[model samples]
Target chain A: MSEVIVITSGKGGVGKTTTTANVGTGLAQLNKKVVLIDTDIGLRNLDVVMGLENRIVYNLVDVVEGNCRMKQALIKDKRYPNLSLLPSAQTRDKTAVSPEQMIKVIEELKEEYDYILLDCPAGIEQGFKNAIAGADRALVVTTPEVSAIRDADRIIGLLGANELKKVELIVNRLRMDMVKRGDMMNINDVTDILAIDLIGAVPDDEQIVISTNQGEPLVGSDCLAGKAFENICHRILGEDVPFLDLEIKTSIWDKIKEIFKKN
Target chain B: MSLMDLFKKKNSGDIAKDRLKLVLISDRANCSPDVMEMIKNDIIQVISKYMEIDAEGLDIQITQTESEGNNGNVPALYANIPIKDMKHTGPAR
Candidate 1:
């Protein structure tokens, strides 16, 4: 059965778009037909993250406003033949599309794809409502910071109020060394407070920066963050996958560099 | 700066967990059916230690009550649990 999932974080810059992009690509790689919808209308960037920014004939606004057909708005990914993206309009404001329009768009997309991943905008506003309007479940992303956790709790309560009870948590950009040193909250510390099943915990990796810059999903690469995202895909498909055990240890290159330094 | 600090200093992770629990109490107090459910579960666990209670008939909610410090009214947790039987042992504490 096709499922609609929204990747949302009430706070900005918590890796919602990255999770949506990678998970969509990962599902497609696993032979599932997936289409990603960028719901951040005024500030659209999922297209750039998917390396399909240059080929945008129509957008979500066009499809909802009847300017173009739904098929016309879909931009197919050549890398993964089963994956597609419907980019948001950069010029239109968030009010341009209502929650009903978003539900309508998702309903039509559901018949053609196995997975429909919506990249939600930051904050609890119209954009957030539009993203979660037709979602069967939600993935709340947060870092191990006080502000992020507070916002995540608020978002969870809001989701519950909306009668959307199937919510899961994703702790992103967790530094294992800091966690071991008692400087940062570990995964358990987060999940206990949030009181939700953890989808995945992505580590703070420089490779993620590179992947985002190249406008590509890191799920295909042999990186730690990519592997965490792949496990998330398996868990989304109802497969039992264990969380990554990121032990605190310096890289061998760091060890070699320390040996060469003389005080 | 020294090894002694490692033994004395509180782990920030623990501190964050404590702070989150307190902060969420207020955040979830507003229109939270989940918060009420969480409180209900907590009440059941704690009261279960003293006696056999009718779990099916338990009811809990957050309501305004008089503050102990003579301040204005504040939100309070109130629970009504029916007792089925008293445990042979005294309060677990």
Candidate 2:
């Protein structure tokens, strides 16, 4: 059976979609049959980020409503033959699909795929509930900002309330330069507040924006954050890989050397 | 000595004061290391019967101090309750 993982965050715009795209792509590149389900219905962007938006004729709602079969709604990724996408319905709301329906869908996909990724919507509403209902594990994404961390903590509390035990942290959109300047919170600072196991840290890369616009991820490239996502995927697959050094620890000497090098 | 040295010396004290303010705020607010007006309101509610406290001048804080053993420690909470300002209508008890 495929390991159903839900990528969610309490707050919006913290790179949930980007993390989903990268991790899902990374797992697919590893020759694992992966299916990503976008549960953000009516406000879907997972397909756009994955570069499979045009191929979405039948979506998650269609399958749930019995309008189409699950196989028909599942869009195949040309980049990775094993990667597929179950797109969200743009015309319907999240309530169109019940949690039990989602469980059934995941269970069916589990037989055919090695990994089933659920891209959850923002906020702790019905959409969030629907997205995490059938998942075996969850990845709580948060930025270093106070608001983002607070929302993540609230989500962690909610996850515990639901008896979901295997939860991990994914610190996204991290700015190393700002962290070094003490203008932003560090990883330890964030981890200390959340008090959870860390899975991955994706550095804030402008290249991500370019790649998203281009309808693909920067994963498999030498981009620092992309490499970190790949590492996270490997770790998820029970592979022991060294964590990326996304933390920028700059000393007085290092600063001076950088200044000297700039001249 | 350069003026930069003098400013550094002055800023060192300011930094300590700033850190003290932050630590106190964190303790009182139980959140980010910044003073919030909600803490002032809480202090007002606690001391309203005892004395007519100046909500604006009410200094509530947490002071985070360095420890030799631990790298980072939780800040200490300090609430300055003004006992002298308490109204004594009768003989002092």
RMSD of every candidate to native, in Å, equals 10.6, 5.9
Best by the TM-score measure: 1
Off by over 4 Å in 2: A247-263, B1-93
lDDT agreement of model 2 with the native: 0.82
Candidate 2: residue A105 lDDT (0-100): 89
- Per-model TM against the reference: 0.80, 0.76
Per-residue lDDT tens digits for candidate 1, residues B1-93, read 999997998998888877777667667776467867887888888888888898899997665577988866566777789998886343675
Model 2: per-residue lDDT, tens digit, A66-142?
A: 99989899999988899999999999887898889999888889899999999999999999999889988999999
Q: Would candidate 2 be rated incorrect, acceptable, medium or high by CAPRI criteria? A: incorrect
Q: Candidate 1: lDDT of A186?
A: 93
lDDT tens digits, residue span A55-173, model 1 = 99999999999999999999999999999999999999999999999999999999999999999999999999999999999999999998899999989988988999889999999
What DockQ, on C-alphas, does every prediction get? 0.57, 0.09
Clashing pairs in 2: B23-B62, B24-B61, B24-B62
